[model samples]
Target chain A: MQVRFWGTRGSLPVAPKAGTIADKVADALVAANGRSFADKAAALAFVEDDLDFATGRSYGGATSCVEVDMGEGPFIVCDLGSGVRELGLDTLRRCAQEGRPKEWHIFLSHLHWDHIMGFPFFVPAFMDGAKIIIHAGHPDAEQALRRQQEEISFPVPFDWLKADIEFRTLETGREYEIGEVTVSVILQHHSHDSYGYRFRDRDGKVAIYSTDSEHKIDQMHDENDFAQFFGHADLVVCDTMYSLADSVSMKEDWGHSSNIVAVDLCHEAKARRLALFHHEPTYSDADIQRMHEETIRYEELTRDTDALEVLCAYDGLCVEL
Target chain B: MASTLEWQVDKRDGGTVVAASGRVDESTATEFAEVLGEHAETAGARLVVDLGGIEYMSSRGLRALTLAHRRGEEAGTKIALARPNETMREILSISRYDMVFPVADTIEEALAS
Candidate 1:
């Protein structure tokens, strides 16, 4: 299974200000130190190897959206956040190249604006032959999507879209089979609540997408259930939108989780790898990088068995298992 | 097969002190929380939880502390955490529980706080 992160930010999409770009450029030039590259490859190598990730690249500002490919026919995507625009374009290119019908299985975590804002701009929805089966945990999913595209809010109405779209409300107690994958959903704590999905492929690789969820300390039963839901998974993409202090204090009950909670749950589940996801929109790349480093250290300090690999998910990051 | 958490509750200087040791993880956190909660029941109770002997503490443990502190607040109880060892201190620090809860290096300091 190959998991791709098309957008990883939470709440809203953001782009770095011009000044931030200028600083990166200035820092790169200073590190270059008057050395002229003979060719583009050497300069590319310098940027890739010499410069740190925050200095050379960004964590990206797209909201939500991730794609999981199991060498299947229909594309399986999670969320329709603003990042879905880019994913939609890529899908169109792939469909044109492969001569395949445009079909997608989109699983929504919730009906929050950031999670659905990309739907109006999604190119596939505008295509006549496209087929989209949107599976959501909430029964009001269609209503929410349609409301977002009302004339007062958006120029194009939901009925104007050309795609053959359908909505399926999945309940938490049962597992559903979609092609070669088995999926299970769990209700989470949030305003209006959200759901977490666990996907198990034919080869027994498990990938869990759990965002916009909170693990309350007093709720041992809920945390245990989450651990079981994440049990022995190959990859767990989780919400790490705030520091532990913030998540439990000022932002308590805000429905987002902290890196410390992410690692602890992953550890409890014995999952192989954890993808720190749902980047806090206000944080710069350096802040996210620092959180990633601290999370890795925290895991090391707490591990009693095999180490759980921790990686921060950035836009365009692809992980294969 | 015995429980992984060991704790002692003592009445000291117009307050209650609960010294907890061992692993306060998923398996033991509830008991740890219960221990702290029981002692902090009285109104205006001065409670100090000594974590110096804890070998390991998870986020659940921190949550347990947070919940206990909140309970104490409602009861008008003054609560402080004392003497977290290196492992416990780092966990507390990382979770920013140190900021929410008053933490001390020694039981004597915790008692005064």
Candidate 2:
């Protein structure tokens, strides 16, 4: 199975300002230092190998959306944040290019505006024979989504969409089979209550997607209990929307976890690889990189012989297990 | 000693002081919220929570505090914290609850403020 991240930003989507982009260009030019490139290949290699992670690569500004590829199975996606607009377009384009029928399954964490705001713009929904399954923990997920396209807010009504839309209310902790993958969801602590999903393919490869969930070390499940729930998953996508100090203090009860909590939890759970996700909108790529470094240091200091792998989730990051 | 958090209200200078002790976590937050609500029911409950005895407090405890603070504000009953212990003080600073509440040096100063 391959996991693809379409959006990793939290709270809302944001793009680098003109000044920020210009600064990056200037910084890159300064790094070049008036030295002429030997060739296009050499220049590309310089940017790829020599450029700083923060200045060269962007974490991107799209809100939460991820796609999990299970070979020969239907398209599986998580969240409908603004990033889904791109996912929807991309999926439609691929389907048209490959002449594949569109059968999409979307898992929504909650019905918050940022999470559901992309549905109206999902182009496939306007096309006939498009199958869309929305799986969520919220009982009112259908109503909430329908309300978004009510005539007052959007030009198109929910019923007017040509796709065959289905809503599934997932039972907590129940293992479900969607196409070729098995999934289990757990309720997470958030204002509107989000659901975290654990997916496993027939090959037994596990991937966990959990965001917008606040985790407190003292309040979280016991290490053993969490280990059982996580059960040696290959990847656990998590919320690290704040720094340790902020998560513990000013943002406490704001329904977001810190990198510290994510690291500690993943370490205890013994998950193979943990992806720090749902990045705070206010945090620059540099801030996230620093946080990533600090979290790595913290993990190293606290860890025993075995070290848990950690990676910051960025838009377009893909992992195969 | 009780295993759970304890809340005791004492009538102090010009206000009510709710002293919290033990672990204020998920298990005790609901009870804590109820206790704060009882004081908030009164028309003018100038309430100052004393966290000096709190052994441990997590986000659940913080949630209860913020809810009480907002509710108190809506009802015209001021809620503040006086004489928080070192741990609680650190938590308050981190959660920035200090900014939301008037942190006084003593109960007298809290009530006076």
Cα distance off (Å), candidate 1, residue A124? 0.7
**What's the lDDT for candidate 1?**
0.89
lDDT, candidate 1, at B105: 89
List model 1 lDDT by residue over A137-226, tens digit each.
999999999999999999999999999999999999899998568999999998998999999898999999999998875576688789
Q: Give the Å shift of residue A106 in candidate 2.
A: 0.7
Clashes of each: 0, 4
Pairs in clash, predicted candidate 1: none
Looking at candidate 2 chain A, the ten consecutive residues that score lowest on lDDT are A217-226
Q: Score the docking of each candidate (DockQ).
A: 0.66, 0.05
Model 2, A207-307: lDDT tens digits are 98888887653454333444466768899898888865566557777888876556656765678888889988988888888777766765664464468
TM-score of chain A of 1: 0.98
| iRMS of each prediction | 1.4, 6.6
Clashing pairs in 2: A249-B94, A249-B95, A250-B94, A250-B95
